[model samples]
Target: SVPGPASKSIITGAINFPFPTLRLTLAQENLSQFHDLDDWGFQQELEENYGRVVKLTGFSGYIDRHLFVFDPVALHHILVKDQDVYEEMPKFLCLDLLVFGEESSLPWGTIIANIAKTMMPAFSTLNLRGVVPLFYEVAERLDFNSISCRTSLELIGRTGIGYSFDPMLPGQEQTDRYARALRGLFVTAFKLQLFIPLLPILMNYCPRRCMAQEGGKLDGSEEGKDIMSLLVKGNATADAGMHLADDELVACLSMILFAATDTTSSSMNRMIHLLALNPEVQHKLREEVLTAPEHLDYDKIDALPYLDGFVREILRLYPPVPVMFREAMSDITLPLSTPIIGSDGTIMHTIAVPKGTSIYVGLAAANHDKSIWGEDALEFKPDRWTKGKADSVETKLPGIYGNTMTFLGGGRSCIGFKFAQLEMKVVVCVLLRSFSFSKPDSGIRWRKTGIMPSPYVNDEPKLPIVVERLRA
Candidate 1:
């Protein structure tokens, strides 16, 4: 039987004895259960079974001993106060290096830190005005009944890196060559993830087979002014450590394309799905969006309160990358906000972790924690943002935007968070202004596919919707 409150452990003169920790098994017996739980569901299970923070070990294969953290205070310690102690998983770093072709971590890390500063204006409220027409044009062309992947790719291609994957004019051949290349890159990357030791060799040869070896330039009106061009030009003026080689340039551009495409598309799909299910919310959003002038600039469109609230709510509830893996760089102690009873009946205020310990930072669970977001934290309620209910809830999550773990926090936070927000707002506003969306007879479900949590129906990534033209 589990220990009761009366069974407290006796403390020694100085040393606090370690409690026997729980073992989270990924063995054959529970593999099905692990797979059955979606990202949010799995995190929920962890917190429910083992307090907000727990140690998971006793794994058989490649799985290593790790600490699972869902408590905000522990999260604050790991991701904010003493982030250097918790380094990003080497596998993830290897993937980044393989994708970006940057061997110099110092320069790449420095560049990532300043990327938002350099690129913010391009994705800013003022600069995004230039792309509003393009966004609307694509929105108007969306079929809505089937795949929206192409629409997202086209958006990122044109405005993000100043490339184009779709045909410019009707009767022209499709410029989907870039899309095909990216598909190959992702497939190769997946293989590399499984065999990370093969990265050095794979990185040397994979680009050739993945359609990135030929080295092609983007064709568009904004060609010279695109982010890629800016990066290339900036690198030219930078020191050797900060400069990107030819292969690195290709890898970096391709990485951005991969990062922006599926994630943003999935997010847009979720927003539409949620809005369609909730007619009242959709109507409110439409009302707010329509209130703005037809010629509204980026700043004007961004200022719409209802729209902002709805987006924030969706991101909070359904972050794309639900959990991230990290490893302890050295021995460290993490402070906890609330004391938890250990397996041996000792109350733990702080947890000590040793070097090489694998750690899972629970992003979705932390976002939905009742202690932080209140009783209705699990529910999808956008009004939390409007009436200042969310503001009242105190949280210590180190997120980059909207005080949520959707974009993460600390030095390694998502750099394109602002760009993503601007893109989402622009897409949502343009779509809401022209069409009223309703859930189709067929329902949709969200599942994690190692890429991001995306809408799926019949075991495929899809969002089926009924779009009605809103008469002005």
Candidate 2:
């Protein structure tokens, strides 16, 4: 944002600053193997690169801050001890500038904060309570071949538009189109899934795998009336008004649909694969889920401690958003219990963080820390989340997540986590009740995406899941 090239000045007197002298090279390196940050064994990389307790510094940015990649102790200092000093980049302008035009840019941090504050109510216990039945429909459809690709099409349509998108009654097709557009809009917002949002019309650049297409009446032609219709009307719900403008309104709603389906589908894929591989853990989780009272309501689902812990453990072992990005504001030196290094050959005994740095906090790595989580960090152990001895340390890692950084920490944690939890629980319950499943063979690997990790089943073993009915 500051004009000209960002200055990369080095400090002559380093010890007086917050960072102790840490080697710069220790932090920055060529990501030669070139997979993804999440797909690669980033925890192992961080551990080997910085020890369990070293600080890493590569890029410097807009503040007196540099990137601080440290263990939990040092991370606690920045996220908690020095909370105000760090925040999400107000706009994440670099991406906007690099990709979309300036008009496409948003004051994203403000938008994100607003989303959390306003939308969180929908994810509260009351609203989250309603998501279970909604999720049950997904599993049912999956089994019965009733679900077309756009599953959330029905859910957000009713919730957002105040009616079902089905138009056999009247104005049904129009409503459905709007709902479908929003769903597609959100799923493809990120750079990875650029199929729908950016590629307004399918051109040559579209990826072969991303060839999934839908025929709509037209995008943005809302004559038939939907949420966009009501949004066009003077009367929108207060929940809808949480957005700053109409564009914000559309984007946020799209985000909701995106959050709903993608997290569920991807996460379920991983959990299902894990269940197949570790039949024992799956049985344990299923047993816990089934133990819930006959009437499956919010309280009953929430009461199942093992189910909750098992889901938390799944998130811990495999966090959806592996890397989070933040930008520095000013020359604010953070107190790190450990040491860090900056890429400009600056030895940070205590890091004298330069401004304008984009900090990538490793969520998956932090979740799997051997030091804090003990040695079995890599294994999927729900007991650690529930019965294990982790009370004292749990409170300290409050980035607004349950116990670990599954949802992240700070004001910018996931607003939809409660809803996500509810969705996961309900689906897990229904699937477990319907069938006892396992991997057809060994050597299946679940690869990671930014949010939706890919479950590469080892053998095309028909996924030969044996299904049986459960009595009501």
Q: Quick one: best TM-score, which candidate?
A: 1
Writing each residue's lDDT as its tens digit, candidate 2 over 164-280 gives 444323222334544454434332444433232334333222111111111121243433223223332322346444534533444445455545554555556556666766778
The reply for model 1, stretches above 4 Å from the true place, is 1-40, 61-63, 102-134, 143-146, 168-175, 181-223, 234-251, 387-389
Write one digit per residue (lDDT tens) for candidate 1, span 346-419.
Answer: 88888877788777788877888887888788898888896323667766677877778888787667766766
Runs with alpha carbons beyond 4 Å of true place in candidate 2: 1-29, 34-39, 52-70, 73-106, 143-244, 293-295, 339-349, 387-395, 448-452, 457-472
Q: What is the TM-score of each candidate against the true structure?
A: 0.80, 0.67
Evaluate model 2: give its TM-score.
0.67
lDDT of 2 at 20: 21
Number of the predicted model whose lDDT against the real structure is largest = 1
